[model samples]
Target chain A: MGRQLLSILLLAPLAAILVSLASRRARIAEYATVAAAIIDLAVSIPLLLRTLSGSLIFAHGYVLLDAFGVWVILCVSIVYALSSIYAVGYMRLLNEEERLPTFYALFSGFALTMLLACVMNNAGVFWIAIELTTLVSTFLVGFEREAESTEAAWKYIVVVSGGISLALLGTVLFYWGSSFVLGPSYAMTWAALRQSAPQVYPPLLLVSFLLVLVGYGTKAGLAPMHTWLPDAHSESPAPVSAMLSGALLNASMLGIARFLGVVTGTSVSRFAHAAVVGFGIFSFVLAILFIVRQTGIKRLMAYSSVEHIGVQALGLGFGGPLGMAGALYHMLNHSLNKSLMFYGAGNAMRAYRSKEIKSIRHVLKVFPVSGILWLLGAVGIAGAPPFALFLSEFTVLRAGIGGSYRWVVIVFVIFLIIVFIGFLSHFRAMYFDEAPEGEIVPLPFTAWRTLPMWLAFLPLLVLGLWWPHGLWNIFHQVFLSVMGGGQ
Target chain B: MFLAHINSLQASIFSSLAILSLLLTFVMLGSHWLKNYVYAFAAQSWLIAALSASVGYFSGYRELYAIAVLTALFRGLVLPWLLMRIVSRLNVKREIHSVLQSSSSLVIGACVVMFAFVIANHMSRQQQGAAHVVILALTIMLSMKFLGFLMLSVRDEAVSQILALLVLENGIFLGSQILVPGMPLLIEIVILFDLLIVVACFGMLVRFLVVHAGTTSSRELNRLVG
Candidate 1:
């Protein structure tokens, strides 16, 4: 049953790609992508449910459907479905009817790679999958063919490819280190690495872990290495941006979390946790600084991604059931909330005919219902209460406060306030500020545009008020599988 | 295991090939012309392929023979051919906007090699009976990485940047061939094909850069700033 669900989950995107390519009409391609995405989301939920019983391995251990992997798959599928729906309205606005089929094809291909990255059981194969995501998404980032989009695509591929090559080197080092213990011909599976971790030289293990962290950190949009993220995210069409932030980053973080799992209980574990916390704190500080001074609306959202990913890093670094649970929860909430924010930004960018926050005024006047949804999403993403991000952030904070990294908890709280203030200030200007002079024309409302926002916003609100029991059970399993009972 | 038990002749053969590949990276770093960079990359790939074959012969990994052929075909022949096509399409021949002088970059590249050697020495210090070949492989692998990144940072042309990235991959491929020859053939083969796709994508993007962005140099591609 688990294997069948996994097959369907993987094949749906492939089917989408085929349908998109084969169809002559743009609407057919768009509808096909949406259908594929919904099927993937539907399949992934049950896949996660089935894996809750225990981790599932298939293809002679090349694919893993553990709770952790399935959770990321769930996040990717959610974003895929939402973005595909959003793209239907968004791409129509671009008026590139002839190019839409190709766009949908690449979009589905991009989704396929992210999903593939999640289930890769071999570390080497996982790196390849991540690399494939970069390759596929570069075109999507440059889909608009504008100067900025093309430039952003260039930088995205170069920086990410360089960074991920470091990950490749680290994986080689890991395999080499394990070879000393497991012989020269063993598979470089996560389980094999974990089994050999204690016996490998501590210094080698530490160096390998740090290299992998920095490498995958670049992909996950953790700061300093997150230079490519803002350019790529802000420049891509809004639906593609949603997928990049909401899906790709989670897949990369899955790699880091799994690597961290490999080194758990080793002598280098303490230092490893500290390094993660260091990057996390640094990213938080950097993101907050950028968030406050931001001008572009999507760029503001991009920095918030950097900030939330930092928070997730902190959760994983804190190393407990609570920390793991919070981080996983944050992944889902951030996906929903960030997608909502991007969809709103997309709507405003289209209606106002500008990408600048200063240019977009009186959002409520323009998009009465979706505008309110967007405003609440901005608040939620800013780590405000009665929204899901707040619950996850608070949970991560709870995990940190009693740990050795208690000082991080203090720093995390101070910045959460700063992020809330900095992020919402832009929204405040957009929502409540009076419109400049002439009347701005609003685009006609379409369910294709606002439906995803409503779908995303409701979940963000409910998850914040009440954490589900089943989710807690899933998180517990993830915590055990990833933390290896060390905490 | 391969490195630890290698005889002196095998050790010398591996070290020479590794050092020669590192030299080609320096050639890439010191050159002003984009074509020079591509040729240097091609040479380096061939050397690494040779090293892969030698390692296979010495270590008895029969699958690496196929890997060596693919590396030579794809990395050595096909990638450089694709890169040359990208270069010929562009009007700019040399890095018209040099971020650093070739001589200065060469000096910095030397420093990077020394730093890499120190790190490699420290890393391999724990292995009992570890050969100097092990240290040499680690150092050349790491040094090529640093030099590749240096090339990436200092070069502005799109083709140069692409070559720098290929150099980075080559460094990792070289390291893996020596350090973990028994890594599954499937992964090695997939990674080779993946690099092909990457270059093809880069070729298309370079054309996009020229037609849409008006320049292949990153200096002019900075329209999307914070």
Candidate 2:
């Protein structure tokens, strides 16, 4: 039954894509996509429940869903489901109804591919699914048919496809090395590799892990390979930006984390840890530098996505129960928080009719509710108190200090502070600064638009204040699964 | 003993074909004509197809024969023809923009091959004979991919960059063939089909650029900076 549900979760979106194409009317396409997203969420609920009870590993060991994968699927579906509402509002507001059919088809297709990527336990299947995400999202990124959109899409495809092709080579290397120990029968299966990690040649494993890191790391938006991210995110439509920054990056990170899981308990674990930690730290620091200089509101949010993903990577690299749990929890928190922030930014852009941060001012005076929600989102994302991101960041910091990485923790705190100040500066200017004379032409606002923002933030606040018992159990199980029963 | 003798012959044939493929990549680097670049890529695919077929004959893996046929049909014939149609439609007969002089690119390509030989030798020092040759082929594929990336970064024409992407994909295919010959045929076909779709999308983008922007030069694609 669980396997059947997973298939439905994967295949329903293809049906949605066809339904979207079958209708020429934009309303039909739009409604069809939203219906598909809701069905995806309904399917994921049972799958997550089944996973929490116990992992569902079937399909000849190729399809495995544990606590971590289940959580990723849940969060992705939630974001997609909610963002479909925002997509309806924003795409219509943008008034490009002619593009709706392609948009809806690619939208659901992208979601389906991401879900497929999360479920595949075979490394080869994993890479193919992730590559499909890129191919599908390339069209999504280029949906607007403008020069900037097309150019961003081109750069996106080139850079990400290049990075992931390298990942495929790494998968081959991994198979070649693992075949020596495990034979060809069970080679490249994540469960098999993790079980026999100690028997594999250490040097071969090390090289393969490094290659996979660079390959999947690029897709996950880890710097210094993150050149295409800001352009693609900023140029894409608001809902796509939310998905790319929120859900898609997590799917790719799940790819990297799978390899990380396999390489654990081997001599090369430390090397892989160092590499992930180093990339994470670099991404965090570089994001601050870029965020401080960014003028576009969407680009500002995009850089912050880089920073949060970096923080999650850093937490996982710290490699203790607390750290890995923190990283997993942080993934969920960041997805909601980042998607909320993008939604807010989308509203602000629509009201002001510009993405330039400085062009629109006195947001509080014009759109008071969304302006506050947007401000709270920035605070949450910047690791302020009373939000889930702050709690996750604190947990990771505690783990780093407990692990005797005081210097790294200190540096991490410094960068977090810098990012906080960077975000505050932009937020203050946008919200509190005076609008130019006659620039306060406020567009009419609606509750449906801000409803998703409230829905996203409520749980964020609840989780921050009190970690629910069920979620804690699930997160702990996920932590154990990732650390391979405490390493 | 008979199978072993045939395998030895297969190894030498594989080595020579691998070297020929590497030379064709360099030929692509030195060529100024877009048509020549496409032709060189197609020829390299033919060599790879032959190598796969030979591997199948020796190993008796029928799936590899299927792979060879797919490679020949798709990479050897269909892709180049599609690219040629796009080229004719765009009316770009030859490369007008050069990022590096032909002689310098040739030098760089030679260095890349030598570098691969050195690294592959050191990495596979324990392996003997045909195993070493296969490892060398893998390394050469990596080097060709690196060269393709270099061309992609430096080339100005969108068409040339697309060609560079094809070279990169070909290099990956060769590496996979040498390293994981037992990969599921499902995945192999999916990768090939993905290449087709990506190339088609890229071709469409090139046409869009030509029709809208009046040139297919990626250098003009600077309107989306930071």
Those runs of model 1 whose alpha carbons end farther than 4 Å from true positions after fitting are: B126-130
Give the chain B TM-score for each candidate.
0.97, 0.92
**C-alpha local distance difference test of each model:** 0.92, 0.83
Candidate 2 per-residue lDDT over residues A58-159, each given as its tens digit: 777778888788789988998898788788878888778887888999999899888988888888889989988988998888887777888888889888
Please provide, for model 1 over A218-333, each residue's C-alpha lDDT reduced to its tens digit, 9 standing for 90 to 100.
Answer: 99999999999999999999999999999999999999999999998999999999999899889988999999999998998899899999999999999899999999999999
Q: How many pairs of residues collide in each model?
A: 0, 0
Which CAPRI quality tier does the interface of model 2 achieve? acceptable
What is the C-alpha interface RMSD of model 2?
Answer: 2.9
Best by TM-score: 1
DockQ for candidate 1, C-alpha atoms: 0.86
- The 10-residue segment of model 2 chain A with minimum total lDDT is A179-188
lDDT, candidate 2, B52-146, per-residue tens: 88877776667999999999999999999988888888888777777788889788877877786665555442334456665667677778878
Please, what is the TM-score per model? 0.99, 0.96
